[model samples]
Target chain A: MTPESNPILIGSQRVRVELIDRPIDRRPLSDFIRDPDTGAQAWFEGVTRRMTGSQQTDRLEYEAFTPMATRQLQELAAQAMDAFSLTAVAITHRLGVVPIGEASILIGCSAAHRKGPLAALPWLMDQIKADVAIWKREHFAGGQSQWVHPQ
Target chain B: MNCQVLLFAAARDLANSERIDVEVPPPVTAAAVLDGLGRQVPRLLPLLPACRLAVDQAFVPADFPVSAGSELALIPPVSGG
Candidate 1:
């Protein structure tokens, strides 16, 4: 119901992470926003982009070392919760070949005020990119593909 | 003893094999298994530094002991959402 009602686990505890070839559910946005106590529910969804600067992208493929990736992501979420005092936080990352405009990562954080979740969202994303055991391959229209390294 | 090492993501793709059974001397450590893996799958050399090892879905440190019949997986850096 409310973000406060759904408290996320914190610390070096266990968390759930799965790798599926199917599409991700977009309902979490509405679910997280339905909280009455949440003064701000900030969400960031990473979708496959069709272009990057002057380069036109055809599609993208994602791969992950599931165990390590899951562990890292859980750690990030836990840290964010402690640092920001977030009410609810959910992150779902899709694997495999995701076409253009499809969601890759869905990050939601709800807090009593806008600043906490707002600040935590970008920080969490940066941590995920820096530490998580995930990699991406960008496929161009000319049948060339390159592994996208972490920035 | 021989234990199967499961590979995932880039490790799996580079090794060209999903799983490999590595034989080692008694009382092996996670590090030893990784050493054996390096010899078995030379392509994994570049990935070892960034790779992490897990036993039955739980991440373990390199010095951790490897029991007989344990299931180990070599997890390369992931690129998921």
Candidate 2:
């Protein structure tokens, strides 16, 4: 398959952001920001689950307003890097169909001290959920589906 | 002039298309775009109140002037992590 449309869209010396259409493997994500000066690397993975409040999810499909999402993600990474004094930060969000147990989003942050990455991880996640232009449609068992609107 | 408003998530489902082209008058504002969509795609209007408008990949106020060539998107409340 041609991965042309889903390659890493933004990157710099300390920041990388991607809107990918495939599964997010956490191995490389953890290693992405690690280096000799890095004393702490914080990682987060958002996985697709089979259940959400008693509904049996068969799968989850992700969609994004690609241009906006990409730009926003890049901004988030940069902001996190600056705010947390991070050595590097990486984020990958998936698009299209994702099976249960697969990761839909991955975030990694590395810093010279533990507090920097640790403090930045959750804050960045919350910001992404609040600001990014991405959505998830949950396909339920027995052929029903619904868009996940936050309450 | 005509400008296309891109739809996403719930808005896309309501409109039944990824985008809708609206015929707008001169000095097209975000309000005018939504008004046009309400007339053309009535199904999309109910959700418009909860959504935000993005012009050229950036969020803007309802009074923001949007050119025909600008990329417009209707942003529903996000659910990404």
Candidate 3:
């Protein structure tokens, strides 16, 4: 399905997962706010780095099976909330070309304690790496590019 | 009947197309669909064994029975964080 037709796969107002074509603003740590009762906020960002183990990368191109990706993302977000006893969680992933230093994927979670938020963010990232349908292609400085896949 | 299998990323570049349609007989299992695709596009055969089949937007095993006209996609090992 097209991005416009991509459904908002939300478990609730507290859990938000979305795929955006444009750049993501990490300033707000996504649209998730630190409500009055929430005592901690944790964020994890997957940025396009210039060096990927020595191969200089100029940018990254991300492609996703939108329908399935969004669905899985929503499921992951909801699970993170329950497992971590979180107040809110938001995940935003970028699609298309992303220049170096831009955040390609960002996740933010709010919880009652620092430990929960800190623990949950890394766990959530692992799930995305294992199951998410999005793919990342690295464009090297020499103009060569290749998709990142299983070894 | 025939079903279309959507391709993506490295698989897409290898197949040289966004999708491929294959003739699948009755009792359309995920394996049957992959076999059909491999016969039609030999280039994609290498990736079939390593890939998972997504039927109607959900991951299914090779023997999983798929209904006619359900959307199918070849999902390679993903790398995202």
Using Cα atoms, each model's DockQ against the true complex is 0.35, 0.82, 0.79
Residue-level lDDT of model 2, residues A126-150, one tens digit each, is 9889889888999999799988767
lDDT tens readout by residue for model 3, A85-104? 88888788888889998898
Better of 1 and 2 by lDDT: 2
Per-candidate alpha-carbon RMSD to the true structure: 5.7, 2.2, 2.1
Q: Rank the candidates by lDDT, best first.
A: 3, 2, 1
- Scored against the true structure, residue A29 in model 2 reaches a CA lDDT of 61
- Measured on C-alpha atoms, candidate 3 has an lDDT of 0.84
Residue range A51-118, candidate 1, lDDT tens digits: 88878789988776665566677777777877998776777787778899998888887778999989
Better of 1 and 3 by TM-score: 3
TM-score of each candidate?
0.77, 0.91, 0.92
Measured over the true interface residues after superposition, the C-alpha RMSD of each candidate is: 3.4, 1.1, 1.1
B1-81 per-residue lDDT for model 2 (tens digits): 798888889988988898888898877899888788888888877777778889989889889988757898889888886
Q: Which residue pairs of candidate 2 clash?
A: none
lDDT of 2: 0.83
* 10 residues in a row with least lDDT, candidate 1 chain A: A1-10
For model 1, the docking class works out as: acceptable
